[model samples]
Target: MPVAYNDDMDKRLIQLGAAVIDTEAHAIAALRTRINGNFAAACKYMLACEGRIVILGMGKSGHIGGKIAATLASTGTPAFFVHPGEASHGDLGMITEKDVVLALSNSGETEEICTILPLIKRLGVPLIALTGQPRSTLGKVADIHIDISVEKEACPLGLAPTASSTATLAMGDALAIALLESRGFTAEDFARSHPGGRLGRRLLLRISDIMHKGEEIPAIPENVLLSSALLEMTRKGLGMTAVVNAQNHAVGIFTDGDLRRALDQGIDVHITPIAKIMTANCKTLGPDLLAAEALQIMQRHRINALLVVDTEQRLIGALNMHDLLRAGVL
Candidate 1:
């Protein structure tokens, strides 16, 4: 059974939720000042690292460290997370002289991480630390220390890792993005790392991959009648047909929109040449163009279809908005 609603209690809960967001927001906002020379040095170390960046943390900081590692890996930086506890039991071998170690601890003295500091130092790898306490064991030992302290936690009890964790994650993102820019990483580079994701499809899929080709393309000769063009459009079901010249060059395009305008003008579909109703010099795309870019062209011109042409402007394929939708490029 549902309990009766308490209006005053509900109001108080809503206000508490808003206050928590405000607290976390302020914590992240304060991190802007922490992006200093030390931040630059940390990025430098990671950028120069030949092996994967090994991240270590305990409890909540460990969760944040995992996310930070993932962000770095996807942004053209090689990185992975190793639990501090696991490092004690032979996992410490994973950290090599070519790698850089990044440790996260709000108190700057997580026992699990401290246990491996000597091993990491012995490996002679660069160590960067994210901690609220600059004078703590982890911070004092690190070659580079980044302060991620916050004024207060969003937790009312001041015990949970709320604001501090948020600050650490933001700093991690700052490091990843700074290195990404430093490496001159482009969208194509990012797509290579994320071939299974939506962004990869948008970047890697070309018009040739999805456009209707050969017999699938609805194209008619410029001298064909409007009635024949309509039949071709129906057979192809692409809602459009390209009007080609004697050399199979796309001279114009006839789409559903053109059919509407021709009807509004009371033109004879059976007797009128397709050229009379076709849009001359219609927008055409190269087969090598990206499908995502094709969508942009369609949107900017307010058209639903496009003809694919070769370097000589000869019609090679055709595609419509539906093709993009079906291909997941929309």
Candidate 2:
């Protein structure tokens, strides 16, 4: 036997979920009004810090603090999360006088966090508190206080932390982005921090890094017959080949797909010159451009490959979409 919900109950649950979302959204939006001198002070303290920003929190705040630490660490700031409970045991040694501690507690009264505050104070470390209660002990004791107060919890019973947590997380993001902007963080700098991510591949990988060079490049002389060009395409295994003149300057390109189209028109591959059936205005890229830019060109034209050439229009390398795929840039 199983219990089933009526349509009325189902509608009520959906409405409840929607209300929760709307409430959280409103709370997060309200944070814009609270950004003032205190926020600026927090940023100044962090920017001046010679060591890491040590984040400490408990329960749900701990989870949000962890994410904030990661965001800060990846975006120019060196930060790490330390559990307040663990700090009392041995983690407090990780913090130094040069470091700044950011403590998060909705009530500004987490016993575990407060217990370690005196020890942190003795070491002359600056404290930044994010809490709903500005009048509480933690807020009063910290060097800087960020008010994250919310109108109400989204929970029906007002017990679960919903809107408050969302507001705090939004505040954390605000801090990270503000610091990121002040530091003049560039896409290349971000790529260095996230080398395993797609953005890293887009920013750090160049066309020459992934293009086929030497024998791997498919190329043939302009005087070669269309049949020999087809053989070169087959031997190199790229779908296309660069048609070079006697001076080794690329003049045109021939592809297997183009050969199919020529065959459909009853053209003879054995007798015709390769240039006769080649595409004259083939798309090409410079060896110094980013691989991502090359991918954009190939995708925009709906093509599969491109020839890498120098300013003199001499073929130096070649690449297909598959090359980008293998290099993890696609």
Candidate 3:
């Protein structure tokens, strides 16, 4: 075809893509009206369960069920996915009396899912169903049924699972997050569940986890010459040094910025004491604070480093942006 014709076809495809997104979005929004006491009852049942949430599904619903299970596990509620087909084999042994079974079937009549209904019932487990047909076999058999019905699929043929899948996923997120809040799941709790992730590192890491302590801490006496402070800064490579008094409490800090200012004033580095040119009463934080919190302090003060101190104001450690970056807290 001609170049112009190809360009026009591309624009039409883009318009169709946008329309599909809009249709899916509207389908999810429509679920807000369907959120009744049934939703609350489902949450209560899951919360009261003593064992893990065993989610079962087939095909696309199976894919979404796995994701929902993962979300529930990472948040507060414990959950895991089980293939309905696999349950027919020996995998059904994984189910226990304490577990709550969550089965997903939009039509509520998948033969595989319905076949295992009797087995699930025999275990004396509570069954929560996410289905379009609440009056169907699976829904009718479930202890609690959540309606995920949608007007239509986004596909033009109305044969593919689009809007219904979106609605199911949104409902799953709603249930998981609502249960998470009710359980008082905190950021620290989430961090523990995801210790390998960046958010986990940020929330769980303390300033002491990344700060330089002991002999590695850069320091100098308040009476030291400006040249001696510069030598200490270079040796420590922290670009600054805490100036301590006889009691070892920090009185001030001399940084590279201070050195530039001192040079601008034409001061003699050999004769002038660091206390004369240092920035006194600098902002300091305790080692117990989170490294993420310390990053915020550095951002608010527009500085590159902060000294860690005790309640008595004695310098115990030091760190800069480089430390935070290396620790993956930045």
Candidate 4:
């Protein structure tokens, strides 16, 4: 009977996983030495492309190609992935003469991909090949060839594509980032591409877009009693209220946190003027400012809310950091 040991096997499995990571790191490091004029030529071809980039590969290479296509598409290069096997079916109709085809193959002899080479040539689409064997058929026929060869696979059997796939993926990332930099892709541009992500919220959200305006803004006259201001704070649900002068300009702000401090000091809520207990140095934001900028001001000042003011110091809106969180700008 096999005995079950008390020691956990999880640590050994973690170390095995680390080995694959270490192997891929070394493989990418070695690729630095192989960067020659070919890499530059590949970038130049992509930069000069008038249409979208169509990526093609087979097996594990196909999986990496799909991710590369996504990265390229998000980074300002219009790109899409086409499985070589599917291209041999009806997918070949998606390609056009203006597009550039980026093909990936470890041995540079994937039959499915090679079968479509003649058709691609007939369409006059330029080909960029990524392969381990430069002398293989795919490389010889390609308009531009990029060498992505690796010394060995991280897999113990030396058959599974481990380091090679990692290297290919890294090359694809390098290409996308290089194009992004060359095209001056800004954070705002990136936000446009990822409207559902946190980065988009940070870059694209504006104060006017998330602030409480008109009656939603809590405000009380400077002569109002503290008890009345507290009711305004409670009704507005912002935990605070602005004290405005007869001219409707914000003079100070009072919050629930302030009320607690006032009570601790034995102040009378009914007789005390709201302006007397209000914060005179309250921070404010502009309606046109980015929501991310508003968050920074609130965090730096250790405050939870801010009043929106115009150039004339008139309060137009009010918002708390919670508003930013609710708007997905946090």
Candidate 5:
């Protein structure tokens, strides 16, 4: 009997969770239509603003506002969150004519947000509002109105922020991504804002930043015996040596695997010139190529090392899998 009772309770809890998700999904679908020219105008104003975007809200809206500000700032638009309550004191000084204000309120009559409107207006900063009520105080006074209204809250009591907060967050994401695309923001631009993160490492790392150059490059002349090539590969420990011609241009490559194959073919390492056993036209990379691309090439070729060459095919650098790992490009 106890098990049966607990099972029924679990079922009820699951149903409630599903209801909340469905309600929020519906709310966002409805909000999609509100993304017309008005939304574009707001993005335009933000793009042209020489100063930063100042976001404001209270309670759950405040939390969402902070996330929106972060997304906008990270994606190329500079932005920050100023709690409406704090702004009424001295935080309002953060706003200027060069800036833009984005205020969020479900009812659009939150006293904290409305109380500061006059000051922002006095500063001549453009105002954009995300509110459930277009006729409410915030929407009525804003230069742009983004309707974040919802049919109903997902809360069984229809009081908690659930569905409305989801809609507001979705709207915020819509605005940020649209602005990101309009500004032609690339992964590299986004990486600059997140230099300490993994995406930044992947997007900003180049082969030149990690490759071994100068004396670190392992190479042997085509006339060198296979034993000399093996010694060069051992000294560099990259498991390979570039075979360069009289002009010092890479003509072939000899790796540990190549040596093994040569030995199996009954060739004497002491007597054979490296040119006799080297793989000609081996895959080479340029200095400016992304380290991420280098990783791909190495993986596809099942090789552990690569020779970096110029357009004329002179060996300028060398790198192994370990170098990429140390540089965090792995």
Candidate 6:
């Protein structure tokens, strides 16, 4: 049976949704005060750690910890999440004296985490705690404690880990970004960690890696007729052809747009030289240029293709927007 819609109920539902977001936003904003000396101290320990930062949490906190660990690992800091419950059952062996342990618990008295506190302390590893209660067992024993308390949860019943989880995740991001800045982590470094992602394609792919080279490039002499250039463009299927001199140096580019303008001007394709119809001093990129930089040039110039040249302006390669799309760099 379909339920009937009530106008008052609809308004109440939207109001409740807005309230939840408002509460969570406030929760996250409140965490800025927690980024004081204690936050810096935690970062210092994690930065000095020779080994990975091992994260431990329970339930919802565990989920946040996993994401935090991933952010740290991708931003030049080596880290991984270890479930506290599993740690007591032998996963604790994953931690070593060289590593730093980061524990998250809203109340800071999680039994599973508390169960292994002695073990972590015995290893002489630095223990950093993120908890709401500074007096809790885990907080008291931590080498550094950064509070992640929220005034209240978004849940009206106040039973769910709503605002608290948001606060914890925001704090985790602050730590990861701070360490990333301190380590001078670059986009290239991040790309190395995410080679299969879009950012990796944009950052790591050079024009040489994706451009059509050698015989695959469409090229002709400057004296060639527009008919010959058009055939070369058709054969190469790049919608464009480079016109070079006797020295194979690119002097101009003849694209579909040039062809349209030539036809509009009643120029005979068979008799007109490509040089007369081609765009002179066309935009070009070097083989060593990044694909992303090439994209910016193409977009800025409102062009669809680019010629790849060497230091001597000799045509070595060619690429179009299609190539960037295929290479996942667009």
lDDT of each: 0.94, 0.93, 0.93, 0.91, 0.92, 0.95
Return the clash pairs for model 2, or none.
none
Give the TM-scores of the predictions, in the order they appear.
0.93, 0.92, 0.96, 0.93, 0.90, 0.95
Tens-digit lDDT string for candidate 4 (1-330): 956545559667777889988988998998886677887788888888888999999999999999999999999999999988989899999998779999999899999999999999899888999999999999999998988998889998999999999999988998899889999989899999998899999998899999999999999999989999989988999999998888888899998789899999999989998878899868887899999999999889788999999988899999997899999987
- What root-mean-square deviation over C-alphas does model 5 reach? 3.4
Which segments of candidate 1 are over 4 A away from where they belong?
1-6
Per-residue lDDT value at 93 in model 1: 84
> Residues 1-330, candidate 6, lDDT per residue (tens digit)?
966657998879888999999999999989877889999999999999999999999999999999999999999999999999999999999999899999999999999999999999999999999999999999999999999988999999999999999999999999999999999999999999999999999999999999999999999999889899989999999999999999999999999999998889999988998888799999998999999999999999999999999999999999999999999997
Error of 2 at 90 (Å): 1.4
Consecutive 10-residue window with the lowest summed lDDT within model 3:
1-10
What are the candidates' C-alpha RMSDs?
2.8, 3.2, 2.7, 3.3, 3.4, 2.7
- Between candidates 4 and 6, the TM-score winner: 6
Model 2, TM vs. native:
0.92
As a TM-score, model 4 comes out at 0.93
Distance from true position, residue 325, model 5, in Å?
3.5
Between candidates 5 and 6, which one is better according to lDDT? 6
Provide the global lDDT of candidate 1 against the true structure: 0.94
lDDT of 1 by residue, 117-164 (tens): 998999999999999999999999999999999999999999999999
Instruction: List the candidate numbers ranked by TM-score, top first.
Output: 3, 6, 1, 4, 2, 5
lDDT, residue 144, model 3: 91
Per-residue lDDT of 197-279 in model 5, one digit per residue for the tens? Answer: 87888888999999999998899999989999989988988889899998889988999899899989999889998888899
Distance from true position, residue 183, model 2, in Å?
1.1
Clash pairs (backbone) in predicted model 5: none
**Cα RMSD, model 3:** 2.7
Clash numbers, per candidate: 0, 0, 0, 0, 0, 0
lDDT of 2 by residue, 1-330 (tens): 756767998879888999999999999888988899999999999999999999999999999999999999999999999999999999899999899999999999999999998999999989999999999989999999999999999998999988998999999999999999999999999999998899999999999999999999999998889999989999999899999888778788888789889999998888999888898878988999999999999889988889999999888999998999998888
TM-score of 5: 0.90
